[model samples]
Target chain A: MKAKHQRLVLALFALAGVAGAGVLAASALRDEAAYFRTPVEIRDGKASVGEPMRLGGMVAANSIRRQSDGLTINFVATDGKASVPVEFKGIVPDLFAEESGMVADGRLRGDGTFVADRILAKHDERYMPPQMGEMPKNMKAPATT
Target chain B: MHAYANPTRFLAIAKPLTPWLLGVGLLLLLVGGWAGLTQVPGDYKQGETARILYVHVPAAWLGMGGWTALAVAGLVQLVWRHPLSGIAARAIAVPGMLFTALCLATGSIWGRPTWGTWWEWDGRMTSMLVLLFLYAGFIALTNGDEGQRQGGALSRGAAIYAIVGAINIPIINRSVVWWNSLHQGPSITLRGSSIDGALLWPLGLTLLGFSLLFGAMVLMRMRRIIADNRVAARLRRLADDEGI
Candidate 1:
């Protein structure tokens, strides 16, 4: 091979090596890599009781209920396949509402309820102007705080 | 490629090209900024907060794009021993770091209203932060190598680091998909964009404007590096004549 071709081969080999390493490393760290587990994962025994972990999924419609103290709230997080009941105490972030994605960080109780220390709202990938009046049908219904 | 390796020829092309790039780039940015900030309507869900996408998305693109440039230059430097490649890589580092930092800052600001947190250790966010640190490290390595009489070793080391660092780029791109992240998945894909056409056009303008500006800045920085090297070589020659 010419010198140029040799160098090209060498560069290609290096890139392949790096990519292979990345794939292997990613697979090895698969469980740790995910930021959160869905309700289905928890139901399938992916999460352990009293072990801190994040549960991520859409907040079930009409699932939000505020306690008398006004600080604590309860809701069910669902991925359609399964649902996990979640309880949180604090000022929930703006955009936290029904029919939207949410990730709660806390622990699972033995009884299967998730006690959240922090709650973060997850925005979906869609964007449109409010004037369009074509918001997702479910989002049109206001959250019953 | 080799013809441009000659600094004089490179400068001949770069000098006149810089102004045109800057002028056009600035004009596009101004128009795009106006359109994004004032012309476009607020998002149905996010309201005015979504306006930050114009700046944030471009910064994110360049941040990742800059590293890709570094890796390509690094490969050329290693394989062809292209003299200009090192200068090109050095020129890209600072602006790239700045854009990466801008992405992080803007994303954080956007996150506060959207994700309700200033930062998260999720896959996408963490990988981006890692990219910033990589840029910082590359800059420090190349700058430290400057004083050495035999410059090839550290420069080559930096180039190799640049190539290796590129592994993070793909990781960053796929993080949202490969792992669950607080950050949303890709909004614009090869198939189509999820954003409405009304909101997407202004974003396209800003992306183009920011990209043009990044190219111009890199060219200007390369010219500056070349001029500084010329001055340094001249001073060295003068000192030699004086037997200092």
Candidate 2:
């Protein structure tokens, strides 16, 4: 083959390699990419139950309840507008605390609850989450007191 | 392409532009850093740590962009046989690798305070690390180990490696969306930026500054490569003439 033809053939192989990797990656991403939602989204019926997803919000004050198993903890995640009760089975992260922003990954139970397999603490760059001085006017719970 | 195909013409254009790019880039970076640090409000969510975005985002962008430029040059060299594209590809690798490393370091530092971990095998972070390795590999293949004589095969192999390694760039970009990782989703994108205008403007300035600096470095390195090639050609001719 001429030098040009040889170069062309090599280039074709490189392009094929890239295309193959992209297709495989796309397939993997479809299965792996989990979408994030909020309590408001769950309340609005936007979050799909039974599908694994990520929920991020502040852990409601005085909402944490540890089960007898000692490994499971229950809490309500609130975002000033809505709240979702979350049941997570595992040791919560060190930063996990009431009034601190947190994210949980798990499926939504049929009974309007989040069954989290993993819990991650979420905080802003400031070493603190937004202080809950007063509950929003829309808050239905008297947990603010 | 014709004008730049010749080293003399390429230098003629690059010589004047390098200083302008480098000087303005440095100045804008300083201004952008000052503005990001002092002027911008502490983020409601991220607070002062959001300032890291000014440096980290630009470094990530340039790192990704540098690889894209290398791939394009590799294509040019392989397909069109552009005389100078090989030199351009070689010129791009070192600084590109440095930027990739910088992005990872800054990102790791930012992650520690925010994500509560120094590092994770998160999709985004892991892919970025892979990109750094790709850059290192490309540089090694093209430049070869010191003291060993490298042949044309290494250059051809480098060009092919560059084209193939480009597969990782998109992977690095989409990794956050693709995996359940600790990293945040995209903030600035082509569709529309989610950040406030106050934060976005300084970020833009820093991006431009860093991109210009990257361009200046590539141009400067290309000139050196061209000069070195000229000396090598002269030495070869002298040896041939002397029958040595």
DockQ for each numbered candidate: 0.47, 0.18
Worst 10 residues of 1 chain B by lDDT: B147-156
Q: What share of the true interface contacts does each candidate keep?
A: 0.69, 0.20
All models: lDDT?
0.89, 0.78
Worst 10-residue lDDT window, candidate 2 chain A: A124-133
The sequence of per-residue lDDT tens digits that candidate 1 reaches over residues B1-244 is 7888788998999999998888888889899999999998999889999999999999999999999999998898888878788888888988899999999999999999898999999999999999999999998888847622222223667878999999999999989989999999998887687887888898888889888899899999888888777777888999999999
Give the CA lDDT, 0 to 100, for residue A67 in model 2: 93
> Residues A61-99, candidate 1, lDDT per residue (tens digit)?
999999999999999999999999999999888899898
Query: Which residue runs of candidate 1 sit more than 4 Å off their true CA positions?
Result: A133-145, B146-154
Off by over 4 Å in 2: A1-13, A29-119, A122-145, B145-154
Give per-candidate clash totals. 0, 1
